[model samples]
Target: MALVEVKVPDIGDFKDVAVIELLVKPGDRVAVDQSLITVESDKASMEIPSSHAGVVRELKVAQGDKVSEGSVIALLEAQGAAAAAPSAAPAAPAVVEVAAPAPVVAPAPVAAPPAAVAAATAPAAGASDVGAHDPTRPPVGLPHASPSVRKLARELGVPLEEVRGSGPKGRITVEDVQAFTRAVMAGEQTTRAQAARAPQGGGDGAALGLLPWPKVDFAKFGPIERQAMSRIKKISGANLMRNAVMIPAVTNHDDADITELEAFRLQLNKEHEKSGVKVTMLAFLIKACVAALQKFPEFNSSIDVEGGGDALILKRYWHIGFAADTPNGLVVPVIKNADQKGILQISQELAELAKKAREGKLSPAEMSGATFTISSLGGIGGRYFTPIINAPEVAILGVCKARMEPVWDGQQFVPRLMLPLSLTWDHRVIDGAAAARFNAYLGQILADFRRVLL
Candidate 1:
């Protein structure tokens, strides 16, 4: 058979990319164009696809191996009549009849459980059936679930086996986990109630008729040891420190009158129900930011060195990045051409990108080339926070919790929905006056909610 060595192809403008994954193993058959390995560079990630259909004979590289162009990655035995043909030579005289090729043997069948045992071990109501929970399935967990659900289970030390599946095809879903959490919380509450109902007796109870505190031993214990920060944690910690030290962050706290915006979002949600796009205040903010960026292009610019001095590099296209927190770390995935997309399209794209990010499925391309960034902590209650500017970007905006505030209306006080906006900019690229002007424009856009749609 013909053996071919698979070498790394010419990856554009990149040298020494770390291999993140190997898709094939020795003796495995692979089709043409199937991905053989994945490489991650500082700028982006790409997969190397096989050039021909063949059986993998040897894999030369493993995960985390730094490779360059023309590096041999694997060896393959090509499939075809020509590759399988024996080398040409003088024919030998036949001595006797040749035996037919041995019959191909089938794989051993899995042993089935006894009938009585099978009946006894039948799954409970709403539980996965036997053999349905295959351990050899994809390493990734079930689909269409939120990250918080998985995190909650791990934190609470809840085993997946004890939880009932409510999603499609007996798959465990977020709602199911949340339900289990609620049950656990209720059980704790009941335990507290029972403890409160128990009769109190002790020195404190005899003196003041109140419940007595339980005694505890303060014996010597083993010393606690601290470990060094992980590589990813160290990087995150350094980035946070750099942002606080270098970026001139100023918090201009103001509330936006979002009553009209809220109504408009609800109306749009009804109109776009068929598209499965839920209109949100964040989408409106994005549109308003895009408009403001167009008017004040300086806010959409980046800092670059020129002539021994820093220069502001103005970008023509608007790529707004959304900060997504994953299990491993924080990742900002950019949404390209935010200025060109409508509210519905923006919402849909944001939802999909956020889902992918939380699942660690976002590629490096999605994490790079952001001209601006927006971080929203409004979902969790907070008045305002001075968010750090993402490096290379001139400006970053933070949206805080929107709440009802009492305001003076000429004659009387009135309650109105107000949202806080915080902005941080690079002082090297943008001056205080320019930053204030940009913030003022953003505030005005947010105040004039109808203008966002136009």
Candidate 2:
């Protein structure tokens, strides 16, 4: 039997991935392609599969251990050639045993309870008991604990019922169980005073003072400590800062007359309810942008070369990315072939992508490949703000809050829903006039709400 070491495969551009789960253990038999461990990066989670059909001999990594490409994950004992091959064996015949008949006995009938017999003979109660237990009684194992305590207990693998409380009404304090656990693990006598006075570390805190506290002296300390940037954050930060510095970004503010667009959204929503698609203003905006791009193909194009070798690269297909805020950081999940998808389809896809992103479930594929981007802070309070262009994409459209503002009509000022559009574009490729023209065309399309529905 040959023992083969299973090392981590090359995941593109990812390093120091943390092992999140161990799918198999030592001595367990695993088939080829069966998952051995699961690792998670900031962008996505992936499973490492067994390279060969064998028994797991050892696991080199544990949960929370940071790993990189070519890191040894486990050792597998290869199955013998004889074990791998199938044997052609005959089946065994079934045998039946015969038994002799014995003396027969008459069985006695069971006597029913007097109350039950009376109930069957007479009328039943308004609500018969029928062997039912009382509904008013609380269910078993349901402890009287606060939600916070329950959450902590679940995280710490501590049973709430087993923990002795020190708070009001027998409430469990976080420190109480943590101290108990430390004492037990250390094999030390559990003293109430010592447990209570155990230093609460790990979190950031300062010492209390009787008078005014002295300020921290940075001069007394050596060199400051610096944390390495995460892969996603590092990329995002560098790209954003580079875009800001390199691009002469300009913004154009405009409002779409979405009265008819709103009505159309409501109408489409009624028809698409069974399909589970929601028609929102953003859906219409995406459609409008796509249509406008088709009319002004230059806007969809990118400036490939600067100065000496000046040329524009016009993309044939539209892959618009939507910036999604995740727990880890901001991620831009692309919507491929946006020009081909209808408003309803776009809405459904966007919803799914947003849901996955927020849940930290977006795959790495979903977070890459974009020709353009759209970022909306309309859900928040901002009216308008310049958005940084995502790298490789020439421009990013920013959507701000839509508010009811008085606008002057032909006769008088009327309250209309106004949406702010802030477009930031890379100056290396796109000229100011071209950018203004692109924004103007998009504005016109949005203002003509009937065009969007059609």
- Which ten-residue region of model 1 has the weakest summed lDDT? 90-99
TM agreement with the true structure for every prediction: 0.49, 0.49
Whole-structure CA lDDT of model 1: 0.64
**lDDT for each candidate structure:** 0.64, 0.64
Q: Can you write out model 2's per-residue Cα lDDT over 1-454, one digit (the tens) per residue?
A: 8887877766656799888667678987765445577676655456665555688899999999998888898988977543221322211101111111322122365564342244335532242222111123333221333333343445444555555554432334555556544443233444556556865421101111122223344546877655776656755765564455445676766666665566677899998789777877777788888877777676677655332225677888888888887766788888888888988888988899999988878898987778878898756868788888876577889998777788899999998777788888777667788878888878777777556445
Off by over 4 Å in 2: 1-231, 305-309, 452-454
Clashing pairs in 2: none
Q: Which ten residues in a row have the lowest lDDT in candidate 2?
A: 91-100
Tens digit per residue, CA lDDT, model 1, 163-209: 54543333444445444443442222222233334443221122124
Work out how many backbone clashes candidate 2 has.
0
